[model samples]
Target: MSTFRLAARVLGLAALVALLAACATGPRITTEADPEADFSRYRSFAFYSPLAIESRGYSSASSERMKAAARAEMEARGYVFTTEKPDLWLNINAYTQQRTDVTSMPTVDYAYYYSYRARGYYVVPYWRDRTDVHRYTEGTLNVDLIDASRNRLVWEGIAVGRVGRSGDAAERGARIDGAMADIFAQYPYRAGMVPAPR
Candidate 1:
């Protein structure tokens, strides 16, 4: 594989990890992560993931599949799904900035002039990298695990990364799963939960 392709895959994995690990402060946590809490209390839920995920190497169909995978993974972790009869509602939103967001305007660059012996005229050749800023969109995905019974946000996790212009169905699923897993890494919904002793 080409270096760039390899880089993309490696970077893709790294982005997934980074996004999952990057957490945003969510609503205050009221329950303890210990065995004392009853997850059944806030069981049924609904969550919206990117309907646009499947369209690059990722197509729209892929997005639907990605959502399914995310839902499935969450379900395996004990959360039940329900739209009309949900105790908790999940809302997923994303914010992205194109590579251009970090780019500057083009500037004139000097070039060495080479003279042609026959014409005695010098010409300077200049060109820019067609893909000067071969870009990616840096974005944040926010997952709100809200409590419908209370009508307030209960848990929130924001995953952040620079998503390349190209993502396949596989990549999308990997990212979604990786991100959600990271969010739930702090599960049981404890307030100010810290990692246990090393």
Candidate 2:
């Protein structure tokens, strides 16, 4: 890969790690649900047979952790986990992309001048404008709830944040769990009950 692309990938990986590891103060989360769809009618949940995050006919480790996280959240909400027919089916997706940030600011620059009278060098300071370009990775996690019978989306949660470059599988899994919890906390409905106004 090109140097730029490689740097972006590294930054992206870092951002993904940060996105999962730093939940309370890092990721920004948003959620939306189908206004017309009744949440109370849903009592059971299942993951899509082939999750959106899957590739080459297999599931990724991150996808498996995401599934486990979602299952916990759903079950806590009184939704049963089932592979068979379910009232709701969830599609989970995670991805990272390179982002560029450009900033400009006024900076102080220094220069030295030779002074014959003083027989020494004098320091002169001036104001200079500078611009900096920064490259980093942005990670996103999306959870979509679909009506199995109608095969239509009913609710969705999205999280976006800078991913840091650190963590092992266990740590990543914990972070994924944190991210999932943050997403589900936005879910306003319980099984067989309408969402209360927030």
Candidate 3:
């Protein structure tokens, strides 16, 4: 292959690898739990709808997806979902912010100037400053586990990452699922834990 063509192919491969890495990236997760609380005592959970409303305007579909993911994870840890008086209440809150980054880059180029005395083209090297603007949206999701009777937060998990605005419903759902899984992986309590097979 020609040298130029080979260089182009290498650049293309690098760009493709970067894109895949970004797509596979998951949200950063942080979790905290009350050390005094008895996690083993919690047996049932119910969604705290009022807290969801207090957070802000969130789509029902998205809320349902998050709740469902949480529900599945809780069940795996030996928790039951109940509408009646429950041992724990689950609440989710999400918000997004717009971020803008501006960077100045130095650029070097050659300029051609006409000189009557030289009777030839003169090349001049000059440096210019170029500004790059990057705009993106960052989103954060907080999952809180509250003691129903005490009305106190027992545990909280948060995940933050860059939010993709243009994706199909299925893609968005998958992202939500993945984020929830990551958040739940931080849960401090596990019922009947077993070692994984190699």
Candidate 4:
């Protein structure tokens, strides 16, 4: 009933409208090499390094962290990590650049306008507020893994999700760790134990 109470209600409604329109997209997938590469034979193979990266239109601190995380990931999966020309030479290279993506949103504007009620009282429909439209820029990160001894490419993975140019080191590390954990879930390298399909 008070002026302050009416203002508060209008603000809450406006906030809710804005958030409902912003939705995140599903993860993206990119593969330069064969994703279906068989890995039934690579039980005891070594990772050259997992965080090797290839980028397009974006910055790449993500790649470096990816490499480190990949190494940790491979190690976690019971695979050996080596740098001295072991059974498998893991060679990972990464690059990144900025890219432009388009987004669409409705525009919403609120103003104090007057309407008359049957009782001759001034009423503001609380400003239904036109839908607001906006555009926001988001970042994408790509990653891949390869086995050198076989001389054939092995596994690859990619994702397009919310990210930051510069962020908390630990948070970035965690992000890399999480992204890689998903990508390597299918670890396509099988060393010499798994044979290719006939």
Candidate 5:
């Protein structure tokens, strides 16, 4: 074994770990808005009645967390929460789906032996390919803003992320908030403000 080879292997392993850590950090966010809509006209916001999140014929726990997160983000952007004559109506929803990811990589297998005749240690290396299959829960959240006066959707934000199966209530809530923050980060405008040219 050479010192250089061991150092190379260590560096490779560290790089691999860093790449995986970056991929697992948070959700991927995407957003879309109608080009013709004037964002500056929207001043107040309200959640839709019988919200799209009522997937179970009634409001679910997840829906409540999502609404709370949306409310915080909306108010932070200077949007007033109102029930009457609001400029924008929000329809937020989320669901999880079972997903599988498959990956393949080349690996080296090695064995060591002591040669009595030579009185030296010898190493044999074997090269092979390894495949891994992982199953996980993928959660998708959608936040839609509609022009109340026109009854048309004006903008939408979406987030997709890996969802862990085990967590306390508070932990789950935090995850939802994190996802919402990621989604809203993509939104182009604040309440009653036009987006600057990009």
Candidate 6:
């Protein structure tokens, strides 16, 4: 009922809101490449067979979307797509898992202030312990680039983030696109790097 208690509660709520906001913004992206691989030799790429992805329980449509996104990104980086004898093989995979986050809310401490007896003011300290349990889905998408000749992984990019429960196809597609963009932005090679006529 007192102003001091109300202020403390307001501060706690503000902190909670900020924490949740930070979690909703975007996915975390990571990329790695083999130092010994010759990136310049890779001028073209092709997607792995649909059967390969479908065997992992992903739908054909999902595979198409991932391939399309990767194709666009690769082309932008000066790589062409080919169905036969490509220099690199591209594979996309994704998985989701349910997670529960438990966080302890910030505690507030108060100190007592004393003054002269005739015009004295006294303060009481309070402590509040709160725990929050949040349930959500975490999703991860991986883009793997393999050297077709050697059949070895040369580069990989992964994006991980919170997934929503909505079944809307359009919204999900947009999320995938955003995540792919973040992933491919880290590709080490640049576009238009072909060798000159010898």
Q: How close is candidate 2 to the true structure, as a TM-score?
A: 0.79
lDDT of each: 0.54, 0.85, 0.82, 0.54, 0.87, 0.82
Worst 10 residues of 4 by lDDT: 50-59
Candidate 4 deviant stretches above 4 angstroms: 1-36, 44-64, 84-140, 186-198
Using TM-score as the measure, what is the rank order of every candidate, best first? Answer: 5, 2, 6, 3, 4, 1
As a whole number from 0 to 100, the lDDT of residue 157 in candidate 6 is 96
Kindly state the number of residue pairs that clash in model 1: 5
The C-alpha TM-scores of every prediction are 0.48, 0.79, 0.72, 0.52, 0.85, 0.78
- How many backbone overlaps does candidate 6 show? 0
Candidate 5 C-alpha lDDT tens digits along 138-178: 99999999999999999999999899776698889999999
What is candidate 3's TM-score against the reference? 0.72
* Alpha-carbon runs more than 4 Å astray in model 1: 1-40, 48-63, 99-135, 189-198
Point out the higher-scoring one by lDDT: 2 or 3.
2
Clashes of each: 5, 8, 0, 27, 0, 0
> Between prediction 1 and prediction 6, which has the larger lDDT?
6
lDDT against true structure, model 1: 0.54
lDDT of 1 by residue, 1-198 (tens): 754455467557756865884564232222223333234566567753323342233345434543565567567666777777687666655557775533333222335565666655554434343223445567666556666666666566666666645557667666666665665565643322333443
Better of 3 and 4 by TM-score: 3
lDDT: which candidate is best? 5
Candidate 1 positional error at 177, Å: 2.5
Candidate 4 per-residue lDDT over residues 1-198, each given as its tens digit: 975576677667756865774553334545565556545544444544333344343436655676677667666766666555545444445334455555443333334544555545453443333443434444455544455666666655665555555567887677667766766664544334454455
- Per-residue C-alpha lDDT of model 6 across residues 1-198, encoded as one tens digit per residue: 985868678787877897998877789899998877777789888986653456665666666777778889999888889988999898888888999999886565677777777577677666687788999999999999999999999999999999977789888788888889999988868544643333
